[model samples]
Target: MMLETGKIRENHKAALPYYYRMVIEVPEHFQALPGQFLQIQIESKTTDPLLRRPFSIAGLSRNRVTVFYQVKGKGTILLSRLQAGDSISLLGPLGKPYPAVPGPKIILAGGLGAAGLLFLAKNLSLGSQNKKSVVLLGCKTKEDLFLLDNFQDLGIPTYCATEDGSFGFKGLATSLLTQKIKKIPGKGTLYACGPNPMLAMAGKIAAKHGWSAYFSMETMMACGIGLCRGCAVATINGYRLACVDGPVFPAEEIIWGKLPPHPPLSPKGRGLK
Candidate 1:
């Protein structure tokens, strides 16, 4: 819940063609955990793009937080044009973090989802003496991949899968996971962050193996806080706010089907709540 002005010390293209990395300099005491995110205002004074964009913290240093993003729209396009020495408003370290689960740990990442999971991998490797933790990365093609070396540098066994057979495994990332999880020996938890479809698949796989899992969901969020109610996600307990309740949730907590279409408005023009 801290709102601070951070200087953009670095904004450059990453290994992937479309992805870019931005490094912001924060105060000394501002600490952020893995799986938490920052809400950034692209422009300092203008009100044009009214909402701040949410980006998961990819990596953290002494006083710098790094975020990896793709220039998908006008806001991000504008963000890409900014150079070093610029300043942006950042609101962050929000939402609950991924749970610290025991036993052997596995991380599954899809596409750009690797950005956040990288932080999680780093934390787990440093905190544990057991070196069995592994990272599974999946992408559409080899060109779509990034950060492979970074993960390997951490001394964790990292595997990759590509849909086109242009990389490690010839099928979906889950295929790699399926083959690997069997060798884990005992009960283990999986932490995943990716597209809804991929998360759903991983959830199903985790269930099939009787393992607990957590998923980091991606959605359109307006306010970083719960005030906007813009990021509601359907759960068994009813709708939950993604910004506050989670960008991360237990895999079993969500109702994975496409939400039923809302009812039509009444003749008086009042819509269903």
Candidate 2:
């Protein structure tokens, strides 16, 4: 809950067309974890866009923080224009992170949603000798996919799916999950982050097989803190603020049917390709 000025070390278009990767040099005291996000002030001198934009943390190092985001609206379009050495305002490391779970784990990501899971995958790869972890990514087409090499470089098994049959699996990433879930030996954990529909479907699949699952929910937010109840998410226990309560919640707690319709992506939204 601190407002800090971080310098953009690197900001450029990523492998995916409309997506960009940004590396910020933060204060040495700054700390963040996977599943948490930062609220970035897109413009420093004007109030045209007004509110800050939220982006999940993709990577973290001693003095750096990285984020991957798509150019969806005016705010993101402005973000993509930022260059290295630009000073940016950040409010963050906010929201709860995914709980540490041992044993076999399956990570499901769709489109830009993969951005949030990259840090988690890195953590899982450490001392991963006995743990069986895999990443299933979905996107619209071959060109929509990014960060495959980063995941593969970690020595974690990674799979991809594209709706156009231009890549790994020919179908939704959820379909691939259905097939992979069958191969789990005992109880395993499912971690997912994607468009609302994809997450809803992944939750259902996890429940059907009696697997423990957690999901990172996405929504619009005016304030990155709990003061503004603008990011409320419907849960079995009533309403919860996505900013503080979670961007991550256990699968069984969410009331999927109550979630708003998934917003259509300009080109494509988060999910496996």
Candidate 3:
């Protein structure tokens, strides 16, 4: 991992409510791939929130990187205050990236979890040729969705699900996946990143259908590197650090029952309802 200073090219509210997007212009030496993340040092002069916050790379170009986040706590509140021309510390391109697989592909995203898959989708679209790929997104309502156009613009078929029936499908994204997967003529790969319950369900569906799958696990971290050992994920092989070993792992390897339950959503907001 490299420690680099990048200037805020743009930091503003996204088209969706309760969400924000930030773009950074980094030096030539900095590089990253989809599924890797950055540890951003929040500029709080007092150090009240001492640790850096982890954000998945949403989009990346020659020298520009984008991250999407929700303001849910003190650290994020500070992050939202940053503006254009601000300089920020970034330690990243950390963690393993999703593996490239051939054949038909299916991407499943839940709420803000969509942030981590955009880059992967972009790469997939470039060499898609005869391959069939699709994206299924889930949220509480239509208003809770964002980046649907970004995916659609790539010509990848995109579908959405909302709990309240405000959008595409009237149920959960996993339900949408179930319906779509059955229609595929042959076996394909599954890639998912979302709330634990959503991911667990996706894993189950993939296993039932005998499709290969990978998942990006979200967890708490004090240090982005493996030194702290704070972001352990329970797996069939025992606990693995989400930072070094993966934020992404083979779906069959994870022990879903051993994972900690996602915290209850607060009145303010939390990922997908």
Candidate 4:
């Protein structure tokens, strides 16, 4: 991993629900992959917040890296105020990336989880000539949904679920996944990223159908690297560090019930901001 200071080219609200996408100009020599994350210090020269914030690489182009985030806490609130030409420190391209397994891929995402997984879909598409993929997204309402247009731009069929029936399906997105799984010719791979509860439900569904699934676990992390074990997650093999070992792992490896239901890291009307 490398520590570099990138200039902020843009930091603007790109969708509904007040989500912001920040674009940074990284060194031309730097490279990253889908699912890889970076630890960013909202204020490069301050100890107020102390810790660096971890964010997934939402998109990358040449030397430009995009991070999708929301003004959730004091740190993010500070980050959101940054404008064009500002600079931020980045230590990244960390964590294990999603495997590039060949198959018809089905991506399951809840709320802003789409931020990271979108890069995975893009990489897989570029790497394989015929990697058919689809995305199923879930949110509380239509306004909570984001990235639908981006997915469609990639030619990947997108289905959505909103709790208030303000969108495509009436129930949870996992219900749509269940219906889709039945129509597949054979076992397909599932990649999911979202809140613990949604992922837990997705894991159970994938297991029930005998489909292989990889999950991106979301947790409060003190350190983006493994030096601090604050982000340890229970698995069948034992406790694994979400910062280094994962942030991504097979669905079967997770001990779902042991994880409590928690709200997403993004701003969701919580007092975090």
Tens-digit per-residue lDDT, 1-273, candidate 1 = 899989999999886445789999998889988889999898887986888999999889899999998767667777887889998899988887788888887899988889989888888878773386889999888876777887888888999999999989988988888998888888788999887877888888888888899888767789979998988888998999888998889999988895333232122322211
Pick by TM-score: 1 or 3, better one? 3
Segments in model 2 whose C-alpha atoms lie over 4 Å from true places: 129-131, 267-273
TM-scores for candidates 1 onward, in order: 0.92, 0.95, 0.95, 0.95
Candidate number that wins on lDDT, 1 or 4:
4
Deviation in Å, model 2, residue 205 alpha carbon? 1.0
User: What local lDDT does model 2 show for residue 56?
Assistant: 96
Better of 1 and 2 by lDDT: 2
Candidate 1 contains a number of clashing pairs equal to 0
- Output the lDDT of residue 93, model 3: 87
Ranking by lDDT: 2, 3, 4, 1
The 0-to-1 C-alpha lDDT of every candidate, in the order given, reads: 0.84, 0.89, 0.88, 0.84
How far does residue 209 in candidate 3 sit from its true spot (Å)? 1.0
* lDDT-better candidate, 2 vs 4: 2
Which digits, one per residue and each the tens of the lDDT, describe model 4 over residues 1-273? 989999999998877546889999999998988878999988877797899999989899999999888678788888888999998899998898888777788888888789898898777666552246778888888877778887767767788988889999989888888888777667778999988888988888888888899988877889888988998899999999998999899999999877777654556665532
